[model samples]
Target: MATFAPANVLDFGGAQLIYELASAIFPAVKKMKGDYSLGQVAKLYYSFIWITSPLMFWGAYLEIRRQSDSILTKCKEKKIFFVLFFLIFSPLCTFILLNFSFESKNVDDIRVYLSFHSRLGMPVWGGIVPTSASVMAAMTAFGIRYFCCVFD
Candidate 1:
């Protein structure tokens, strides 16, 4: 049987790896911006999204599976709280996804967006939200699993 400690450690390590991968990709993305046409940019964006989706889903699945029993027990104990929390957070997750999709545009527009990330005149929230959302999702999953393990 797999140990929980190793699983938890791997989860965190995977998250950090993903973070570093994203950071590395940002520079390449910035370079590619304005070089490609609209259709090309759209293709690239969707390609990245498609590639990452399976990985993210697998990570989430692993997290949930790790704490399945505990989460079930917790839901049994605090069903209402779980439901309410899910209700409130679901919209936030949706908003994040919408923002991610909305940001995907023509290469020219993409260049402007990339320029914003270069520590220049950028809207604070613009640069922060995407990165923050990713970190938050990973952290949230880790936290919930930890909490479930501790409580149950």
Candidate 2:
């Protein structure tokens, strides 16, 4: 098994990496604008997704392209493989599909989040719900990969 830690970090933690980038940049965004319309907020959020999705996909590609047996194959246990597969792919897939369908499926949530953003500025915990979500996505991705590698 490959023993390199950094490669795995990049391979699986893409979402968190993007989140950290966004977190670092968001203060500047907040400073540049006092408030945003629902549409503006949605556009900004979508734009971020569009920009970051490729990087995350690239990470997934790297993980799959590992020279050794794939994570699914390297696993000594079938149950563990399925579990890790679900944990890793589900969030990444959901994050992608949701972003693609976001405008249609999440109109109400966006409006509400926009209202909160207007009233209170960025959320104290994270810049926005999307940021929090991406963080969750990153955590899930990292957790699943770490388990798969360690337990395999």
Candidate 2 least-lDDT 10 residues? 1-10
- Runs in model 2 deviating more than 4 A are 1-38, 63-74, 83-96, 99-111, 114-152
Query: Root-mean-square deviation of each candidate, in angstroms?
Result: 13.5, 14.0
Model 2 per-residue lDDT at 2: 13
Error of 1 at 92 (Å): 5.5
For residues 12-95, write the lDDT of model 1, one tens digit per residue. Answer: 555445434543654333333333223232223333443364466557657666766776677668756554443346446735
Cα-based lDDT for every prediction:
0.44, 0.43
Model 2 per-residue lDDT at 150: 46
Instruction: Write model 2 residue lDDT over 10-78, tens digit each, in one string.
Output: 234553454346546543223223133433333344335434644665565455446325544555456
